[model samples]
Target: MKQINIFSIIAAFIGLPVLFSSCEDVLDKKPLDLIAEDDVWMDASLAQANIYGMYENLNYFSHWNGDPITYRSGGEGYYGWDYYNSYNSDCQADLYWGHWLSGRGKDDTGWTPSTDFGWDAFSLIRKTNIAINHLTSEESRNSIGVSVANDMLGQVYLLKAAFYFMQARKYGGWVIVDEVLDDIGAVAGSDESAAQKLKLPRATLQETYDYTIDLCEKAANLLNTDAPSGQINKGSAYALLSEIALHGAAYLSYYDGINVDAYYQKVIKSVEELDALKKYSLVSGAEEYKNMFSDYAYAQTCPENILVSQMNESYGYRDAPYSHINRLLVNFGTALLNNNINQSFQSLDKGYSMTNAGAQIQPDPQMVEKAYYVIDLDRKARRFEESQLFAENIDIVMEEDRWVPGAMREKRKLKPTSSYTSISDLMYSRRDQRLAGTFVYDGSEFLGNTIYFRTGGNIHRDSYVDKAREMGSMTGILYSKRVPQYREIVGNLNCTNPIFRLGRCYLNVAEAYLSLSTPNEAKAKEYINKTRVQHGGLPALTTETGGELKMIYLDERVAELNMENDRYLTLLRTALSWGVTDPTTGYPTGEKGGIIPELNRGNNPTKKLEIEVPGDYMVEEDFMKPNAYFYREIQVPQSDHNFIFTPKKRYLLPVPQSELIENENLWQNKNWE
Candidate 1:
């Protein structure tokens, strides 16, 4: 028998330790002991044990860490195989292997398929299919009570839908396996010709997508409405449905398909149905919103999270440790910083005391550019003049208050050694809350500790030199979101990962409305405003055209969902809807514009400052220049960031080479060769 089915069957029958426990509520805990395979489907609780295995394959998003320079060997062994952070397609992270964009990798050879994206999801599918098959059978249902059987089937169906959706989005066309193969004997036997005959070929992309939708619909009907946190329910199915509908609608609209509007209607209906459940609502207020990402306990209670994967310490699946998350983004202890001009000396000892503190990956310059969209520039300039320096010239103005540390930073006067102005106060204390919550800028206070992301100098005494290849910088900017809260229980990094929230649903509706033949300005704005007004205190959208509004919607997604691993997908989908030509290369992929440039590292222009204090006394500048302190900051290049999309080929990942040989009838994606 194939290992995929064999393992799943063994797990299903033996009963793994996966149990039904909520992020807060403790349900009846299953024992760690294994049950006999024959007796597994005999009872409701035992059958439920197999269902828990389905979620084990779920991806947690932001674990995409690796050797930024080498590109080989990194990440939490399982999650983020997409190389999301460093692939540098849409994310702020640096890229390691740039050639993959050109449709070449170890598996792209004509003889075999590629394993670049690790697209071996067949095992997970087979496992999911087997569980579903058994749970829906007459004998299993009779043994497991009617209600329990329905609920178990629903959960399995939901898992199946998600797996198929993932396959469809990545591979476009995929082999559909809705049932467990009892002919595993033939498949594993010496009759190679017979096995080849039985091997399923790829289905059309449309069929794959429709089948996923049907699976989700069935799951929604069968799932329990009152399932606890971490368990899939009716609401989760709707959330999945809405996402699937929006994706389908956008893709269909891109190709001018006839049923695009119908799919859009489904998107709206599904989201509204989810909302009608009343099981979740967006968390209000700035502090409350921050808690959704920072504090695990608060996250568990947040009403907005519809499909959340739970992490726990005692027994449940714990996510990557908090320290790992910190190290990947902040480089907390290693302090890899840009050696800016006239920079002050930094001592590694001064930063976090942890051993892994300095392997920091600073945000790409493009990220800072996106952050600007959240604020109203005109309003800030007119009403909050002090914020202008920080808002526009963040690289030059956001300096560390060297003399004032910790909580004292909020009250201290700008020291002579610091470039610290009133900008931090204007930005954090009064501006949009999302800015403070999402990023760690200069003059920001995190857990009462002062965060210093200064440019124009070497801030770390013992800096990691290799970070230069990774494009490390001292632009007084760092990336921080969903990090452990300062007051949270220590070692509780098992935060609930949000799969669907009301805020995203609103975005979906807004986009779908805008995509219609006659865009609904008011309806679209209404949905967009719900997120803006509730989360950021930003004004509601009222007078923007459809194109302008689309930009705003994209900006909001970057602000809110960047770290959650949606950037590349968002860019891809948007590009598909309206094709673009590469400005630099003049390479047009399709009739419509859909091209995206791969931007590169750039440096900000030098700024001359007049300080009352002597050059020797300035901590912002350690080395004194002959005439004036010429502070040069690192910036994201306005043009090609070292990459360009090759339209169709880049959008869909190539099928794995092994999969091709295993199923000779399968066709490789177009242009992959």
Candidate 2:
């Protein structure tokens, strides 16, 4: 084997992660026929190449940590997965995996092997195991294969563990496997004892935790510690260890019923090493801040990211959510313009029923208002005012920040970072920098020939509104945050979707140090202050600032890593009970059912059908008490019914049933039924 060099990092960063570009994207309906392990891994270079493919597999969006809720964006409606005809579903609580039926549903568990998602989950594990055992086979034992084999095995182990973690989070516990147990052999057993023995039961959470930790450690030992990041670097080992240990702590203490500070300590200690690596920091100020998220961030992971998934910018190649199509797909929802003299509604429901109708996942007034406060009030001048629905959020710091309407996301098109500069200081004042990177207020130089749902392709919003006098009256409020002034040629930009970033590491270090301060006050202060200094954040130990390690870090984290980062995952993993909830508008629980009346269908000019607001919706508060279930942040739809609907259990996804049926030795986790 050759001596490792800086080029090793370069190769891992650029070349290797792209190895399985077309082959590994999990969303591909067309699957790739994998190469047999015997044909590869015999030589060092080939083994190295295969390792890249495995890493690429990890980059798929389906491979990352996921959120439970999908937002309705404009706050006008709610529906996704379950009962969301927009997606697909049986509308049944018994089925856990479907587009409309959310990971939110709870019912009979332990899915059968034949279900669709279960099949997908099964394939992932099977693929991971095939890679795992092949690396351990005899052909891989020669001088070249040993280290390569170990690295491969450790990675597959980590991925397997990570996969199960997703399942455990969703299904409570899940079926797990280590060796590449063959399906045909398990099924071929003729004797009653053999057949009976092949059937598996559920494994305990403790057993899974121990298995994950061991795999991480073994992978750490095999992969050279100083190796570059893209290909399972030592940092990856530490990351998995930290995640598994923290998860273990949560499971044992909260679920399996045992307190394990030792596990917490392990996570903290592991993360400390990553912190010392000096490759990351949280960007300070609004300009460098917004710039950190745009196309400028291409080929770069912020200093704090442990692992990152890079997008292909290829059509249908990247994760479905990160694609250019979703971001700039023409307004195939409703028509915005018509030649009629009045601002008539050009009803163009694009080729679908309520299920297939077009919906711009715009940010609700609530999210925009909070973002205004956090960005405008906390940072600069006011830009946009709070809409009437959310006007009370102005001074209320404790209001639950709404989950981001995922679709109103910025294109990061060819706009300057300072595009968020405040003109109307009253509107844009006191907010986080992330707001500017994300939204396009009135001052932005927006290009449009944007396609309206009523019209087909090659049309612009400007042309429609200006030429079509009837539709000119409709303004920003119509699309709301969905149609932010887009700047780039929506089709050509090579923007890569960031799946993981290093910036959160600073946040991680900050959180750990802050939490530690309660007991080891001095030591905690040291670590906490160090992170702030490293990031050029507000200084700690200041007289006016209270100088308390915990509070300082908490404030700094929200300021530096706001919306782009998953505040929810960080909060949940840490077992921190924090997140705001507001009752400004009362939710539509079943008690209020039938009172709001069903949505009406008509295009009557005199007989109007406007939206109705709940009568108890307008009380305001200064701060909201965090709810128990929403430990950090759990996203919810904007609809009234969703506000009343509680989320749990179905919150996490299950291990697809395929692998369970195939691997005889692996047992199913408990209570999925």
RMSD of each: 9.4, 12.8
For 1-673, candidate 2 gives per-residue lDDT tens digits of 0111222333544634433434222223222234444655566665566545444434322211133122122222232321122111111211011111222211223323233332134445655766665577686667465765676676666666666654454454555554333432242344445534434455677776776677776666666554444555666666667666755665565556565666667667767776565544555544444444443242354544445544433333223433222322224223443343122222333231111212222222233342233322332222234332123232222323232444232111111222322222323344444445444432222233222211111122332433321222111212211222234333333343343444544344444433332434455455544534443332344332223333344444433443332433443333322111212321122221121111110111111011111121111110011111111211222121121112222223334466566656554434233
lDDT of each: 0.52, 0.38
What's the CA error at residue 548 for candidate 2, in Å? 12
- Over 4 Å off, model 2: 1-36, 45-51, 60-120, 137-147, 184-198, 225-230, 284-292, 296-298, 301-305, 316-325, 328-359, 368-424, 444-487, 491-493, 509-648, 651-673
Residue-wise C-alpha lDDT for candidate 1, range 169-276, written one tens digit per residue: 666767887644433323235443655544778887777878888989999889888775456788878878877777766665554455577777878888888878
Clashes of each: 28, 51
Candidate 1: worst-modelled 10 consecutive residues by lDDT: 20-29
Q: What is the TM-score of each candidate against the true structure?
A: 0.73, 0.58
Q: Give the 10-residue window scoring lowest on summed lDDT in candidate 2.
A: 600-609
For model 1, what is the alpha-carbon lDDT of residue 179? Answer: 46
**Superposition TM-score, candidate 2 onto the true structure:** 0.58
